[model samples]
Target: MKVMTVFGTRPEAIKMAPVVKALEASPHIQAQTVVTGQHREMLDQVLTLFEIQPDHDLNIMKEGQTLSDITRSALQGLESALERFQPDLVLAQGDTTTAFVAGLAAFYAKIPVGHVEAGLRTNNIYEPFPEEMNRRMLSTLTNLHFPPTAESRENLLREGHRSEDIFITGNTVCDALQTMVANLPPGRPPELSHLPPNCRILLVETHRRENLGEPMQEICRALRRLVKDFTSVEIVFSVHKNPRVREVVFPALEGHERVTLLEPVDYPVLIRLMRE
Candidate 1:
């Protein structure tokens, strides 16, 4: 069976890498990758770390791109690729614009779509912005729903998805994380060299669209309080690339000696940093 796996963000790449590897290992399956390039450099970093070179790269990223731009570009790019590849089934993981549009394109082409990490819901569509809606929509079009947890499967069932179509596969992120951790070279990442000996590490990662403005500022303020109260703790935050996130984050968190606000690290580095 020929399967086209489409993904484009760091989170999606991390989760989908293990699934792609599993597919490649299967004697009966031919696995192919298509990257929408929705996240550009960060996406490429994960791909390189996982050694997943896409058969088709739709370089769709643009500065100041809107949701409509992403959806339109991904739909157009994926449609052409779907026509050319014509896989037996198309697979998309998580709830990015890439996943939603790729699945939609496959539906339009009368091809089956397999959704990985499916059935996640906040019940509030606007809470996570488009992600909650994206996954919910994809669920309607998906032939196979791979939900990573029992709760996720239940969510799909409650939504009237057929039980036979739902498969309770464990999260692939854990698989990826374990694989990387096992292969990690001895010693700490160079970035953490400045960390005081025996200090507790507090890794902070926040880039939710719902928390972008005031909520994000409040989080930064909370982090400030944490640093001030906990002298022995060091905070290493891998800042998001979005300027809006940075605008409030920098003002609240920057210039603090205990808070290390650095550029987002690659997947392995992130894992390593978290380990440290």
Candidate 2:
């Protein structure tokens, strides 16, 4: 069996790495990888850490690309790659535009699509903006749904997906987390070494589209309050690269001594930070 896996973002790379490894190890499966490059540097960081080199890279990232740009680029790039590779099945993970478009392209080509972490629904599709809708649409295009929980499997069944096509597989993020934690080096990360030994660390990651303006300001204000009220509590915020998120976050929290705003770390570093 030939399997081609497509992914682009940091989260998708982390989640799909284990599946790609498993496919490569299988005696009957030939595994191939394609990267859409929706998140260039961040995506590459995860791929490097996992030692995954893609067979094809679409290199679709641009300075101010819109959602439509990403979807259109991925669809075109993947269609050509799929035509060349012609795998028995195409696989995509999570709810990024890359994943959704990859599945859509495969469906158009009459190739079966296997979706990992499928059947996740907020019902309010607009709540998570495109992510919720992306997953829902992929659920319709997918031939095999690898849901992370029984609840997710039930969600698929409730949506009228055949039980035979749905499989309850555990989340790949947890699998990646466990592997990274086990291999983590001793002691605190060098970046956090400036703080006192007894100081407690609070890691924060906020980049939801819904939290863009006023909500983001409120979150920053809350963090500022927390640092002010507690001397021993230090915050390590891995800020998103989006200018909109940075605009509100930096001004609200930057000058504070206890709050350290940083560029996003790679997957293993993130896992190590969480473990510590």
Candidate 3:
């Protein structure tokens, strides 16, 4: 049967790349990748890292786009793709807007939906905002729930989902890590490559709009305290492009000798940097 994988965002692509490879390797299965391009540039980076050429690119990103906009765009775009591709099954990864909307579209199309990295719940709906709600709704429509861990499987069970349909496949994030790191590029930045041997490298990413004000300030204060406490450790933070995040993180981290705040690094470089 043909399997169409719909995803957007870098993290979803990383986790789904292995599934795409597996489907390609299987003689009976044909895997088609569809990217919503919710995170146009970053999603493309992961796609290149995995050497995946998407069958369809729904460039749905818009400035000042809200959650409603993403959900509507992905649903409408992926619905057309589902009809055109006429796949036997639809697969989506994680709790991204693209994933949730794709699953919903497939459900409407009466195509079986398989959710990868499913069953993750903060339970507190608003803590992760729409993500928690997205996963919950996706779980309702998922014919196959590929939970990343036994704990996640148990969580699905507690939510009254069937046990037989839930599969405890260890987190595919680890699988992606193994595959992506094997062919990592060489000659990284001098600042990163020249760090002290075996020195701890901290990677910080913060981009939730709700945390822009006080929470961000608190995070900056914590980092400043951390740098002060550990003078020898090195930090390479990839600041988000959001002006709000930049405004808060940069001013707070300035003048710290050990911390190097830089623009976003590509996937391979970020992976290599994280490994060291």
Candidate 4:
């Protein structure tokens, strides 16, 4: 059987890497990969790290891209890829716009969709904006639901999906982590150079679209207060490329001695930071 895997963005790529590898290793299945350039630079790095050469790349990212922009572009691009591949099953991972578009395209083509990392919900629709909605909608279109935990499987069951269709596959991020860890070089990566040997460290990575403006300010404020109170503690914030995020993050945390702000580091660097 031919299976097409669709994903975009760094997080989605990272989580799907192991799945792609597993699919390639399977003797009975032929796997194809399609990428929508939802996140250009970051997405490329993950693809390079995983050594995945996509069969199709829909260069859909645009400056100041709205959710509608990404959704529409991906839908159109995936329609063509779906027609070309004509796969028996379409697989999408996580809750990105590309994933939703992939499932939608597969539905239109009368092909079954296997949703990886399916059935995850925050319940609050706006906490993560379209992502929660994206996954929920994908669940409706999913023929095979690969939920990470029994809790997520229960979420599918409660939503009236068949128990047999919902499989507890666990999180693929853990699988990707194990692959990265096996290849890890010794010692701290250069990205964590600001660390003092004896200092307590906090590594932060947050860029949810819903957490912009006041919520972002509140988080910055809390971090400021944290560093002020704890003399030996330091904060390393892996900042996002969004101008809105930078506008708030830089001013509030940049000049502070205890806080060190850096651009998004590679997954290997992140794994080490999390380890240390």
Candidate 5:
């Protein structure tokens, strides 16, 4: 069985890493990894942490690329890979544009798609922006659905998908977390070099389009209040790569004492930071 696992963002990579590893270890299955490069550096960090070498990297990320651009480019690139590999089934994780495109491309090619970590829904399509919409659409196109919990499986059942095709496989994030936690990298990352020993660390991250502008500024304001109220607590924010997010975040959080703004860290580093 030839199974090509497709993903793009860091979260998808983290959750899908264990699936890829399991596929690689199976003697009867041939696994191919295809990365869409939607996340660029952050995506690469997860791949390296999991020791995953992709069979093909689409390199689709570009400066200021919109969702439409990503959809068009990923669909075209994956089509080429499908034509070349002709795999028996395609596997996509989560609700990113890359996963949706992977399913759409596989559907167009008359190949079955196995959706890992499937059937997650917020009911409101616009809450998570395109992700919620993507999840709903991907379920319609999926053949095999691997929902993480009974709740998620119920979501699929409510949507009229066949029970035989749905399986409760649990989430891969737990597997990945266990692996990373067991073999945690030594010492504080250079990103946290300046932090004093044993002081409280308050982590922050805001990436959704809905939280931009005023909402983001409000979050920064609350962080400032936290810093002002708690002298012992230090703030460590992992800024998103998107320029629009940075524009709002950097202005509000920059130049504050004990508030350290940083680029995205490696998966293990992030885990370690959270642990401390």
Candidate 6:
């Protein structure tokens, strides 16, 4: 059986890498990979770390792109691929625009779609913006639901999803973490250039766009206070690319000696930073 796995974005790649590997290992299944290139640079970074080269890359990245651009591009691009490849089933994972659009393409082609990491619900449709709605809609079109946990399967059950179609696969995130960490080389991330003898390193990331403006300022203030009170500890924060976050974060922790605010590190560097 031929199975085409579609994913974009770093998190989706990380989670789906193991699934792709498993599918490749199965003698009965032939696996194909596609990357929507929604987050081109970041997606490639994770793919390289996982050593996954896509069979198709929909390189649809654009400056000032909107959600519609992604959906439309993935739909148009993946639709043609679906027609050409004609896989037995299309597999998509996570709550990303790429995942939903790929699954939608499969549905439109009258092809079965297997949704990995299915049935995760915050229940507040708009909390994760369109992602929550995308997942819900994909569930409707999918032939198989691979729930990561019992809680996720329960959520699907509550939403009237068929029990026979749901499979409890546990979370694939742990697999990625283990693989990356075990393979990560020494002395990465310039922020971790200096380690105090045998001292432990702690990594913190706080640049969620949702937490900008007042929330960001508040977090900065709290971090500053913690740095002031704690003399022995060192805090390294990977700053976001957004100018809004930079404006608030810089001013809030300007004079702090212990806190280091650095530019965003790549995935491998991030993994090393986290491990240190």
Q: TM-score for each prediction? A: 0.97, 0.98, 0.94, 0.98, 0.95, 0.91
Q: Which candidate has the highest lDDT of all?
A: 5
Candidate 2 stretches greater than 4 Å from native: none
Error of 5 at 214 (Å): 1.0
Candidate 3 RMSD to the correct structure? 1.8
lDDT of each: 0.91, 0.92, 0.87, 0.92, 0.93, 0.85
Question: Per-residue lDDT tens digits of candidate 1, residues 219-275?
Answer: 998888988998998999989989989998888888897999889888888888988
Q: List candidate 1 stretches off by more than 4 Å.
A: none
- Provide the lDDT at 266 for model 3: 78
How many steric clashes between backbone atoms does each model show?
0, 0, 0, 0, 0, 0
lDDT of 6 by residue, 164-256 (tens): 999998888988888878877777556766645555344667755468799898888778777677766677788876678889877877657
Which candidate, 3 or 5, has the higher lDDT? 5
Candidate 3: pairs in clash: none
**Cα error of candidate 5 at position 36, Å:** 1.3
Number of the candidate with higher TM-score, 2 or 6: 2
Model 4 is weakest, by summed lDDT over 10 consecutive residues, at 186-195
Q: Of 4 and 5, which scores higher on lDDT?
A: 5
TM-score of 6: 0.91
lDDT of 5 at 245: 89
